[model samples]
Target chain A: MGFLSEDAVATFVDVLVRLVETAGAVIIFSGCVIAFVRFLVLAVRERRVSSFTRVRLDLGRMLALGLEFQLASDVLRTAVAPTLREIAELAAVAAIRTALNFFLAREIREEREEIARDTAERDTAQRDTAQAAG
Target chain B: MTDAVRDVVALGVVAAGLLSGAAVALVTRAPLAGLQWLLDFLLAAGLLRLGATGTPTALATAAAIVAVRQVAGLGLRRARAALAVPAPEPPAPSP
Candidate 1:
């Protein structure tokens, strides 16, 4: 192959940066979409419709963590070179966020189930007591 | 301003919106069933834009992002409910 000129090198670097930015954005968007779908399904099944209060608290904490991770990634991506460094940061951030979502989902599910069961038991006890008195 | 300062400014703006969203969710008891992902996406976009160039525009952009997310989340939750499948029952234990 012929030697590349300085102008060609600059053009190539610009295109590469654009490509990285596009890819990173797409990855983040798609991953978040999937996580959201999962959250919706889990929340419905868990019957946490009345427990938004708890989730709101959880979200506040989660948002803080998510923000810290995302900001750190942005800082690294902007401050570092070599391109791949930014990609690595993106991957790491996505993975961490996904893991956190999963953990939160599981916790919500367990707590909701416990609440449902307790409500059910209390209702059943009330019914039995009324029947005995009658 | 330097890139570092710009990044910090952006982060602060995005953080403020995020905190506001979280506060709204907590205080208003809005549904969280499908908002987490939307919020995360908004937060990410906000951080990216605000961090890139420090400006008042960044604050407006972040607010718009969160607003869009709130709308999308309501639609997503409804759609999800309509499309839900019945979960299978667990096997019964031995007597």
Candidate 2:
């Protein structure tokens, strides 16, 4: 019945937990917004033309990378806090995520190069075929 | 020591060791793609560290700076190549 009741302390802790959760969410949201803006700026600077098809590809890749970045940041902040055990767990997760990104980036670059090479070969083949037909 | 400093030093040593190994591999004409794996690990650690600290805006800004540096480097190389090459004559018209 006193001011020092256990219930009061429990309620206070609950409120503190909620505040921390809310702050974490806000951090992630702000990260996403920043990523979107950066994407827009890069697209413009790159002089990218916006065909529906091309735009879709560009947005997908950029957003995927951005979100990956955001997640990576979240995992990092986990370790930075005072929970040593949680830090170890999160560090493992971060390592896996990084490996995934590395492989994905390499695949993307390789595919892009392959596509360019194929396009050039196809063009040469078409020209040869057209010349023979004529 | 701070995690950041520890990571940087670790990565630097790894990079240096890999470079030396790569040089040895080059002499032996062996594949050296494993160096790239180390780089990938460092990149992941760096991105996570960046994410842990400041706001998303700061991370985005850093990413933008990296992209700009890459584009500028490419453009410079292209311009240099252009200057080095003679312009090709117009294709001869079909007889």
Candidate 3:
């Protein structure tokens, strides 16, 4: 309807941005906590880099998700642009986040490749052992 | 409200980073690994701070944190690779 005013819409966007950013922070925090626990457990039980890699991989995924959410919030923050300064700030923030996101993605890809290579090596070793034993 | 939440989260993040970093260092016995983990958590904290404050200074700080993390992470990866044991060579063929 025509009932909503411009300030009202701006306020709504502000609220939405805050909600989105908070949600992103919560996701990142919980992911970090989970990864920390996993790291502790793996450290105690296996003490191997392989196990830690999986934990890091999962953590990286979570961070990437959280970063995207925050980036969305950043875009939303300027959805109803008010001033030139605000737009410039948004651009600066977005640029930094985009760069960080790129690196996070690359690290995740590297970890996934490492996990795949490990699995292949393990499977080959198992098959050879089975054949030698039979 | 955001300020309070930011403070609490920042404290929690630092603590988590330290605890996990120590655990990793103990398990791997590698200072580089621990430092890398610590920086990742700190970067998360910086991001959170930026979200809450949305100020230019906060943005700059976040950017700095990310920069340090990338540089440190790369160094740690190289150091670990260098320190890694080489894969065992295949058995020699029959003469």
Candidate 4:
């Protein structure tokens, strides 16, 4: 492709940043919506409130990923010619988002470990039962 | 660096970070603890470079984010470990 002019390049970067930010928001929102819908459907069909942890874990993972994108876009927004005040604002926003992402990640990890442990325990119990029956 | 070059590099880094995140999500079944750290490091480096070129904001932002993440992650890991440890059993009923 032909080279873009300086102004065009700057505008392109600005658009890209906005696009990424929007996409991040969409990902997070859609993740939550989808997870909720899935849970509702399951609950209705099964007549039980199962799979809550799975849904929450999936949603948390999506939110963490989306937050990463949002953070990147925020950083990119100041790439062209950022003023001191803008930088300060960016610092504040980035710090908050980073903290959110960190907690979301930790929660996701804990849930994953819990699920794994449950599965392992179940399998061990089943194996022992089968051996005793045999 | 010139504005065009800088913009290109910044865009490139962001793209790489996104791609890496996606790849990790797709390929890994485990929790993203380790890969997330790598992704954050890459982003911090990219933002630092952007800040060096007259955008001190990017550098400061990156530094603040990384610092918080590291400190919080340490505390979280310790807390998680503590939670995982089984509580000591109470002494047997009095004789």
Best by DockQ: 3
- In candidate 2, chain A reaches a TM of 0.49
TM-score of chain A of each: 0.42, 0.49, 0.92, 0.83
| DockQ (CA atoms), all models | 0.08, 0.03, 0.52, 0.04
How does each model score on TM-score? 0.33, 0.33, 0.86, 0.56
Residue A61, model 3: lDDT of: 89
Task: For candidate 3, list the clashing residue pairs, or say none.
Answer: none
Off by over 4 Å in 1: A1-3, A48-134, B1-39, B47-95
Regions of model 2 farther than 4 Å from truth? A1-64, A75-80, B1-95
When 3 and 4 are scored with TM-score, the better candidate is 3
Tens digits of lDDT, candidate 1, A39-132 = 4454446544344334433443444444444444444444334577445644544454454445445544654664577679889999999999
Model 2, span A6-36: residue lDDT tens: 6666566545543443343334333333433
**TM-score between model 3 and native:** 0.86
Q: On residues B18-88, what C-alpha lDDT tens digit does candidate 4 reach at each position?
A: 55444434433323432443344343333334333245566566556556655665664677578769999
Predicted candidate 4, C-alpha RMSD: 12.6
Deviation (Å) of A2 in candidate 2: 28
Give model 1's DockQ, 2 decimals.
0.08
Kindly indicate the candidate among 1 and 2 with the higher DockQ: 1
Per-residue accuracy of model 1 over B6-46 as CA lDDT, tens digit each = 35544553454355445445543553532453354455554
Report the CA-based lDDT of candidate 3 relative to the real structure: 0.82
Alpha-carbon shift of residue B68 in model 4 (angstroms): 17
